[model samples]
Target: MGQLPTDVPWDVNWDKKFESQLEELKQSGSFDTYRKKTIRIIRNPIREGSYKSENLKGLKTAHVSGNYQDIICFELTPGVNHQSQQEKLEEVYLHFIDHWDNYDSALSSRNAAGRTVEFTIEMPYLEEGYDVERAKNTVYKAVKDLDGSRITQEWGDECLRLTGEVSPEDKDVVKTAIPTTVDVKFNENTLF
Candidate 1:
């Protein structure tokens, strides 16, 4: 299913509208700077702000720990409601694409050689019966359609990589089977 919005205006008041909400985000000392930077980057550029179920499941965080390095975190909240688990994940998948690089940089660092790098992308989920294969494909589609020019100057492409693995025990929610047939034998001659 297509989880994004339809007929969204490309030009809208993204900043003035969400300013108050963003200010409240600063309470989290860990996310203060990153959140501010994201606002500046997304306000004017991403004119259309819509939610997909992917956004719900798309809740993600990136962390980096090393000498002389402070950890940072980033999350994608599309603000969309998906009625079903699969739909929620799809919404999150789409939302994550909007800020992939921000998440990556927060979790990355430069080595002695001066090349920037991140250890890994950390994404956790609260839903059971989640589909890894489906999620991977969904993310792939999201990043491939990323809009670079619309984002703030601070963001980049590194966060687009879906490099995490699923825990082995993860399972898809069990669904009840539908009745396929009714047992019946007709004895026409014995109908006397």
Candidate 2:
């Protein structure tokens, strides 16, 4: 996994805010409440196929989409290892949206310090009805073929199971562990 940029494009200094909120959340026991806004799942291409003769001799060209979402995350602390945090957030986020919204996948991470997570969440151009789940199936095969393994195989498999495509006998899984609360008595102004 690559590193998410520390210099995010937003007005808020999310890093500082996250640290402050994390402290408060630790005290209050409602950590999930610290999440700023709804995390969005953006698609990133995992791989593509070529029409070349040697590589395509016995194979046909194909396009593959990844199962993982590009999360636009807002956090309450810096202690969360960036990559792991993004991945974990995606895990819980996918389940939450699958149950609550028409969400497919997401790529979430914190913005710059002062910018509100709302700025990105409120992007006017953010189109809904995106086929994130479909993209996941496409990407899974592509990613598996590219590196001989899937980047988010576990997540993909779990999603399939949750949607009833796989059997419990196939794998041991836990898909509903997302935090549900935060420390502060958050009002609109508090933002967490």
Candidate 3:
């Protein structure tokens, strides 16, 4: 699980591109609106919608702004050992900002590097004599072996829930790596 800080101030990394876009916004006639939106994002960036904020489909990146025309793109960096709730995760990297006219191209370029694929799999139903810890260990080991993957596990009423991200190209490998007996289901829309 990813943990977000409740009282701690989040650190923001202004990329070169974002910095320049911000300057342009500052000089524009709509500077006040853009500035307020940027401040709101810096103060609490995880909120989505209404302000044209959304998590980019199939990726760990997101964007938010006062209007559709001027958008700020950012990437989330989950903290180590944080509890698994996605909303609670901390750390944001502001990497890009551009007009709606150039949004698609900017998104495409960033995704070309690598897209994040999120998955949810249920642990297999264990027999009475089977060791639950060992079963979990197997799943954890499989995910750990992946090149770029992070997962959070939770025990539910009837099954164990595993959710996390991995490189798009490694999706198939991850599926095969899970224990054969485990019954898993992937969220189709989340697969890159």
Residue-pair clashes per prediction, in order, are 14, 34, 5
55-144: candidate 1 lDDT, tens digit per residue: 111112121111112222122124322223224332111122224344433223211211111122222233244443454344344333
Candidate 2 stretches greater than 4 Å from native: 1-15, 37-70, 73-192
Task: Give the per-residue lDDT of model 2 (tens digit) for 1-192.
Answer: 123344432222224444444455546754345332223112111111221232211111111111222223323234433433432322111112212122213123333222111000111122244343544454343333431122332333223211111112211111111112211111111111
| CA error at residue 51 for candidate 3, angstroms | 10
lDDT of 3 by residue, 1-192 (tens): 112234233443333454447546656757546534443333223333221223332222333211122233333443422223445544433334344334334333322123456677776455454456676776677777675467788988877778776666767766775666665555322211
Please say which candidate is ahead in TM-score: 2 or 3: 3
Could you say which candidate leads in lDDT? 3
After superposition, the stretches of candidate 3 with alpha carbons farther than 4 Å from their true spots are 1-54, 57-113, 124-130, 145-147, 188-192
TM-score of 2: 0.19
TM-score of each: 0.17, 0.19, 0.41
What is candidate 3's local distance difference test score? 0.47
Give the candidate number with the greatest TM-score: 3
C-alpha local distance difference test of each model: 0.25, 0.25, 0.47
